[model samples]
Target: MFQRSISYTALLVGLFDASAAVADLTADRVWAQTIDMIEEAGGSITALATRDGDNLNISNVRFTFDIPDTDETVIVSMDGWSLLEKGGKVHVEQPDYQEIVVKVAGQDDVTARLGYSVRGDMGVYSEVEDTLIQTWDIARAEVKLIELIAPDYDPAEATVEFVLSMNDAISNMMYMGNGHQQSVQSLGEMAFDMTIVTPAEDIDLSASARMRGLMNEGFQTVNFKGTPDEILAELTAGGGLRANSALDGMEFKMEGNVEGEVFNVSFAADKASSNVNIDNGNASVSADINDIAFNAFVPAEIPLPLSGGIEKIAYDIDIPLAAAPEVQQVHIGMEYLGLGISDTIWAMFDPTGQLDRAPIDLIVDLSAGVRLDRDLIDPNIEELMEQDPTQFGSIESLGLNELLVSALGAVAIGSGDFTFDMNDLQTFDGIPRPEGEASIVVSGLNSVFDQLIEAGLLQPDQLMPIRMGLGMGFVATGEDELTSEVEVRSNGGVYVNGQRMR
Candidate 1:
C-alpha cells in the first residue's frame, strides 16, 4: 500500500530554537536543489518558479520525467506552494498538492487535488550539506483508500494505456500519528521502466480474478487506455505507516491494449534497482512485471508477520491441482467476508500484523488437473440437522422461529481464503443451489476469540450458536473437540446465510 503525509514538525525543528540559530529558508532554494537532483538523474525537471516575502511562494514546479531502463515517463508537477508564518506558527499555506494524475502528451489525465496542512515551523539557517536526508517520513493516518475509475478505451483493437492519476495522487509521502512505531518517512528519486503496446502480450488474472469471484460485485475499477510504448516514468512515491516510510522513483514498461483502457500487457523494472534501498529492511514484496503475467517479479517476497494487531497473517501455500478434482479454469474466490486490517493505525507497521484487516474481495484462476495445496480457502456451507426427527416439533413448540434467522448470522469469513467469498450474505443456508464445498485455510480464530473474550466483546455461552452455526454438520466427528471441514453436503441440520451489516 502506498502511503502519503505532510511534515511541518521536522521542517520547523530548527525554527523552534530560532531567532539566531535559524536563517532564512527560501522556497526557491529548496525548489532549485530538488530540481537539480531530478535533472542530474537524467530527468527533465523544468518550469521551476519561486517567490519570497512573509510567505515563500514557490509555484508551478512542473516537470516530465523519463526514468532509466523502463519506458513510462511519469509526469511530476507541483503547481502551488507557499510557506507562511501565522501567529508565530510556520505553515505551508496554499499548499494545494495534487495527489495523483494520469498523464498523456495530449490525452485524458486524472489530476487528484489534495488537501495538505501541517503544524510546525521550518527554516534553513545555513546551506547544510545533508539538509535532505536519505529519506523523509511525512505523515501517517488510519484511513486512506484510493478509489479510481478506469480511463475510456477503444473497444475494437486491444491496446494498453494507463493514466496513473499521478498528477493529484500523492507519492513520496511520509506520515505519522497515534499508532505508529517509527516516524514516517519516504525515500527519493526512484524510477521504473516498462513498455506499452496494443494487445497486451499476456497477463495473469488468475490471482486477481479469484479474489474477485467471491464478491458478486465487480472488483475495483482500474482502467488504462493508451498506446504508450516503452513508457519512461520517473516519479517519487512514499508515505507514512505509523513510522515506516518509503520513497521510490521507478521506470517501467507499459502499453495500452485497449484504446482508452490500459489492459492486459506486460511491464518490468529496470536500471534504478541498483540504487534502491528501503530504510526499513523489513519490506517483503518488490518485483518486476512483464508480458507473461499481470505482475512480474524481481526478487521480492511477502513481509514477515509481526506481533499485536500488526501481525502479518498469511497462509502462503500452493495447492496440488493434480490431486484436486478435474475442473476447467476454476473461478476461484475467497472464504472470508468483510475482511480488513484491524482498526489500529499501527497495524501495517507491526512486523507481524494481527490479521489487521481483511480484503473485501480476492480472486484466482485454476487450470484442470491442478490440485491446489494453496495457503487459501474453500468456499463452503455448514449444515446443522436435528439429531432426532421429533426434535423439530419440540423446538418449534418454543416459538423459536425468530431464532432461526439469528442463527444465520453466526458464521463469517475469518480471513485469508475464507474471506474471499464468505463476506457476502452475512449468513447463508443451502439455497436450492449450493456453491459447493467451503474450502478454506484458517488460523488465529482461537486467538481472535480469546481477544474478544478478554475485551468482554464475546461470551463463552455465545460460542455454542456460533460453533453449531459454522459447523459443517452438527454430528460430532471427535469425542470432545468440535471439528471443521472444507466440504458441505445436504444433511438434517439447517443452513444459515447472509448476515446483515451492522
Candidate 2:
C-alpha cells in the first residue's frame, strides 16, 4: 500500500515539470509543456483551459495513465488549477482537494482523496538554458481512502479506513537536458493510520506508524527518446540510480485479531538512515538503525509478552549485476550491538538468576569472489534456472574478515578464508570442495555451562559429550580461554590443531 501511494504521488508530482527551454515563461507555455510531457510518458490529460489576463485557469482536470510493469490504471482528477506568469517565473497552483482512483485488473478498485494546503509558494518553476528547476513548500498534506469496491466482498459488512498525513514538507526538483533529474525533499513529520472492522466475523485490525524529520535525495537519468518499457529495460541493464534517505525517529504499532486470538506488536527506533547506489552493473546498499525496541504479545501462544531492544543495528552489501567470466568482488556485513531482552521475559527462562544478564553483541563481515554466468536481474531468470540450476553463478573464494559473538558471560571470535574448487563437487557431497583454515577463540564457556547446570537449564550428562569434544579439538590459551584451528585439505582431510581428525 505504501508503494502504491508513492507511485501515485510520483505521477502526480511529475506532471508539474512544466518549464521548458524557452526565454520567456508564460502560463500557456507551461501548460503546453506539461501536456507534451504527459503525452510523451504515455498518458492523457483533459481539462477546460481559460485565460484570464496573465493567469491560466484550468478546471475539471483529469489525468489517466497505466502504471508501468503492472496491470493497474490510475486516474487523477482535480477541481481546479491555476498558473500565473510574472517576472520570468511561473507559479503553479495546487487544488485544495484531489481524487485518485486505482483500478486493478481482476481485483478490487481503490479510491483515495488527497487534501493539501501550502503556506508560502506552492510551486515556482524557472528555466536556465536547457535546465529546469522547481521549488515547492507544503504546510500540510493528507490522503484518505474513500472507497473500495470488491466483487466478492460486501462493503456494507465491513468498515475500513486509511489515512496518511504529512506536515511541513519542502522539495526541490531539477531537470537537465542531458536526461538527468534530481530531487531533494525534507519533511518535518509524517503519520499513517489504518483500521478495519468486520462485524460479521467479529474481527478487528488497527495499525499506525509515524516518522519525524525525514530527508531524502534522489538522482536518476531518464531516456526521453525511449518508451516506458524500453526505459525499464535500460534500467534493468544498468541505468543507474543513486538515492539516500535519513530520518530522525520512527515508530509503529499494530493490533489485530486472528481466529479469535488477539495479538499486539510495537516497534520504535530513535534514528535510521540508508543509502543506495546502482551503476554500471554493480550495486551497493547500506542501512543503519539506532536505539531500536520491539515488543509483541500473543495471549494464546505465550502468556508473557516478549520484548527486546538494541542500541544499534547495521547492515551493508555490495554485489555485481551482470555476468562476467572473471571473478567479481562481493561484500556483506551486519552488526547488532547492545541487544537485550526485557527482564520479565528473561526471568521466565532464568528465574534463579544464576546466569549473567549482560546484553549480547554480534558482528559479521564477509567478502567473496564470485563468477556470474548470467545477469542477476535477467527477466527470465526463473525459467533459465529451471533448465540449469547452477548457471547463475559460482563462488570462487570467500573470506570472513571479522566475526564476534558475545552473550551471557561468554564470548567467541573467529576469522577464516577459503577457496572453492568449482570442478570438484563429490568430496563435500555435491558441494564445491573447500580448502582453508579457521581459528576460533572462546572464553568463559566452562563457566557458563557450570552456571547453566546449577540453574538447572542443562544436565551434566547432556553436556559431557560436548565437553569431551571440546577437549579433543581445542587447546587452552588462558585461564578459561580455549583456541582451536580447524583446516580442510583439498583431498577431503580435516585437521584440528595440526592433528588429522578425518
Candidate 3:
C-alpha cells in the first residue's frame, strides 16, 4: 500500500512538471503549452478546449501516463476545470473533486482509485518575459482512497481506507526559461489517516499522522528535451536540485487488533527541519528533530505500557554521485542525545534498580575518501556492475573523528584514521587492507556488567568469555577503566595493545 501511495505521488509530480511550461498569460497559449509539455514528458491528455471570450473552458480533462521503470499506468480525470484570462493574469479554476486511477499490469492485476479535492482557488499565473509566476492561497486540499482491488482479496471481507489533507496553504512558483523552476509553500496543518480491516484474520489496523506549521522551498533545473533516464543523468551530472523544509511539530499514532489482541503505538516530535543540495555531481543532506517522545502498549506481550523520549535526533551525510579521477571526500554524522526509557520498563528487568537510569546517548562522526570508476547515479550502473563488479568504486581512506556511547553507568569513546590498499582484496576476507590505529577508552564496564548480572539480564556464564577477551586485548588504565590501542598493519595484521590478534 505504501508503494502504491508513492507511485501515486510520483504521478502527481509528473503532472505538475507537465504544467510548468507557461510562456504567456493568454488562455490559448497556456493550453497549448500544457499540451506540449505533457507530450514531451511521454504523456497524453484528452480535453475539449472551448474559448468563450477570454476564458477557456476545458472539459473531459483526462491525463494518462505510462510510469517509467514500472508496469503501472496512472489516469487522472476531471470534468469542470477552466483557465480564465482576467486582466493580465491567468486564473486556474479546478473542479472541487477529481479521481485518479492507477492500474498495475501483473499477475494480480491490481487497481486503485484515489479521490482528490480542493476547497479554494488553485492558483493564478502571470508571465514576466520568459518567466511564469504562479501564486496560490488555498483553504484546503485533500486526497483520499476511494477503492482498491487486488487478487485474493474480497472487498466484502477486507477493506482499506486512507485520507490525506492540508489546510490553510499558500504557495508561490516560478517557471523560468531553460527548464528552471522554483517554489515556496507553507501550510498551517497537514494530516493523514488510514485504516484496514480483514474479517478472516480478525485484524483491524488504523494509523494517523499530523504535522503543523509546515514550510518548504525548492529549486531545480531539468533538460526536458531528453528522455526520462537521460534527463535524470543530466540533473545528477550538473543541473542539480535543492530543497529545504521545516515543521513546528509532528505526530503519529497507530492502533491494531489481531485475533483478539490489541496494540497501540504513538510518537511525537516538537520541531524538525531538513535540507538537501545536489550540485557538481555531489549531494549532501542533513536533518534534525528535537523533543521526541514515544509510547507503546501491547497487552499480549508486555503487561505494562512502555515509554521513551529523546532530546534530539539528527544525521548528516555527503557523497559523490559521479565518477571522479581524484578521490572525493564523504562524511556521515549521527546523534541520538538524551534518550531515556520509563522506569516502569527498566524495573521489569532491574527490579532492584541496580542499573543506572541515566539517559543513553550515542554519537558517531566518520569521513572517507572514495574514488569512483563509474557514475553512481548512472542508469546503467547495475548492468555495469554486473559486467565488472570490482570496477565500481573503492574506499581509499577512512577517518573516525568521534564515537561515543553512554548508558547504563558505562561509557565508551573512540577515534581512528585508516588508509586502505584497494588493490589488495585478499588480506581481510576479500576486503581492502587497511593501515591505521584506533584508541578506545571504556569506563564503568565492570560495574555495568555486574549490575546486568544482578538483574539477570546477563548470565554469569556469559561473563567469562567477555572477561577473557578483554584481558587479552585491553589494558587496565584505572579503577573500573579499560583502554585499548588497536592497529592494522599494511601487511593485513591486526594487533591490540601490541598483542597480535590477526
Best candidate, TM-score-wise?
3
Report model 2's TM-score to 2 decimal places.
0.78
Task: For candidate 3, list the clashing residue pairs, or say none.
Answer: none
Worst 10 residues of 2 by lDDT: 1-10
lDDT of candidates 1 onward, in order: 0.30, 0.83, 0.85
| lDDT of each residue in 1-502, candidate 2, tens digit only | 1111222136236444556245566788678878988998899999999999888998888888987987787887767679988878889887666665544442457654554333455787777666666777777888778777656557889978888888877887777667777787888889999999997888899999999989888888645466655655666566877899998999999999966989999999997899999887788999999999999998898988999999999999999987878999999999999999998887898888898789999999999999998887676778898999788989999999999999989999999999999999999899999999889999999899999998899999999898888999799999899999999998989899989988
Task: Give lDDT tens digits, candidate 1, residues 76-120.
Answer: 555655655344323455432344333433244433333233222
Q: lDDT: which candidate is best?
A: 3
lDDT of candidate 3 over 61-129, digit per residue (tens): 788888688777766666757999987789989878888676665445777888989997687878766
Candidate 1 has an lDDT of 0.30
Pick the winner on TM-score between candidates 1 and 3. 3
Any runs in candidate 2 off by more than 4 Å, and if so which?
Answer: 1-22, 25-58, 61-76, 97-120, 144-162, 194-206, 221-239, 255-264, 297-301, 322-326, 372-394, 421-433, 469-476, 490-492
Q: Could you tell me every candidate's TM-score relative to the true structure?
A: 0.26, 0.78, 0.82
Ranking of models by TM-score: 3, 2, 1
Off by over 4 Å in 3: 1-24, 33-44, 65-74, 95-117, 142-163, 193-207, 222-238, 256-262, 422-432, 490-493
Q: Considering summed lDDT, which 10 consecutive residues are worst modelled in model 1?
A: 208-217
Of candidates 2 and 1, the better by TM-score: 2
Off by over 4 Å in 1: 1-21, 40-42, 48-52, 85-91, 95-101, 104-502
